[model samples]
Target: MNNRAARVALALICGAVFGFGLSLSGMMNPIRVRGFLDIFGAWDPSLAFVMAGAVGVATVGVRIMRHLSRPVLDTEFHLPAARRIDGRLIGGTALFGIGWGMAGFCPGPALASLPLGLPAVAAFVVTMALGMTVHDRLVVRSK
Candidate 1:
């Protein structure tokens, strides 16, 4: 297949796998996620294990990939180049944390939960897209 087709196929496969993993780990459930975040209340520790497993897999994967001269499907791994944390980064992170704590749905789990056909999740996704568009136009383009 062509390069574009290969990239699209890889993205789809990766998304499917990620969604399935989130569902299987109960991360798609807002209640479960909120419970995990509620340390002062009836907190759940199950998500901690899930996060640990994900981190472990990622650590190993990154280490293995580091030995390779280049990615199999790409010329190079497009890792983040930014090292300095600026005000924009801090503000964005705070906004994300506030949204996640309030709605109990980060972008990944929110998108994964979209398959359930819930109005709230749909609204969240729409708002997320709008936020991204605004940020892209105002912040990203300005920079």
Candidate 2:
């Protein structure tokens, strides 16, 4: 009914759509991801199209958002303006890449594929959540 409620609803819908898309695109499969990551092996290039589509959609959405006078729910847009590269940013990105490369599944895909009842996917999701909690409590707190 209110603007904030509408925004929240929209966000939920968007997230559901994204998760569905990831599932539909086979991005939730670690095997598929691993295949894509494997350069010399049986390389699966399907995820490239998914990544490209997402980037295109995000670019357009960002442009549209920037052109808007103000956010529908909030008085100001909550956009990150950090242009400087810092150690935390680099280290976090490297860590994320290493984990993704090693496991062949990121958080979204791991959670999305949990319905398949794969033990590895389940374990990856659980460990990732635990790592996030620990990072939040220790690394974030210490900073």
Candidate 3:
């Protein structure tokens, strides 16, 4: 396959694997996710295990990537260059965590649940898109 085709195929495969993992881990369920965040209430610790597993895999993946000179389908790693932690980073993270805790749906799981045809999911996706667009125009473009 050509480089572009290989990249597209890899992205699709990765997305499918991610969606399947989310479904199997019950991350697609808002109740379970909210339970995970509710430490003072009826908290569920199972999501912590899932997060740990993901982090462990990511740690190993990063180590493997560090050993590779370049990606299989790319000329370079194309990793993020930003290293400084500023107010914008902290604010963005706080907003993201608040949103996730409130809605029990991060972007990944929210997108994964899009096929369920739920009005809540539709609203979440639309709001998320508007937020992204606003950030792009106000923050990213200004940068």
lDDT of each: 0.93, 0.89, 0.95
TM-score of candidate 3 on Cα atoms, chains taken together: 0.97
lDDT of candidate 1 vs native? 0.93
Query: Which of the numbered candidates is closest to the native, going by highest lDDT?
Result: 3
List model 1 lDDT by residue over 1-143, tens digit each: 99889989999999999999999999988899899999999999999999999999999999999999998788988899999999978998999988988888999999999989999999999999999999899988987
Query: Taking the tens digit of each residue's C-alpha lDDT, what string does model 3 give over 1-143?
Result: 88889889999999999999999999999899999999999999999999999999999999999999998887899889999999989999999999999988999999999999999988999999999999999988997
Better candidate number, 2 or 3, judged by lDDT:
3
Task: Write the number of the candidate with greater TM-score, choosing between 2 and 3.
Answer: 3
**Index of the highest-TM-score prediction:** 3
lDDT of 2: 0.89
Ranking of models by lDDT: 3, 1, 2
Off by over 4 Å in 1: none
Superposed Cα deviation of residue 30, candidate 1 (Å): 0.4
Higher-lDDT candidate of 1 and 3: 3
lDDT of 1 at 133: 96
* Model 3 residue-pair collision total: 0
- lDDT digits (tens) for residues 106-134 of candidate 2: 98888878888999988998899899999
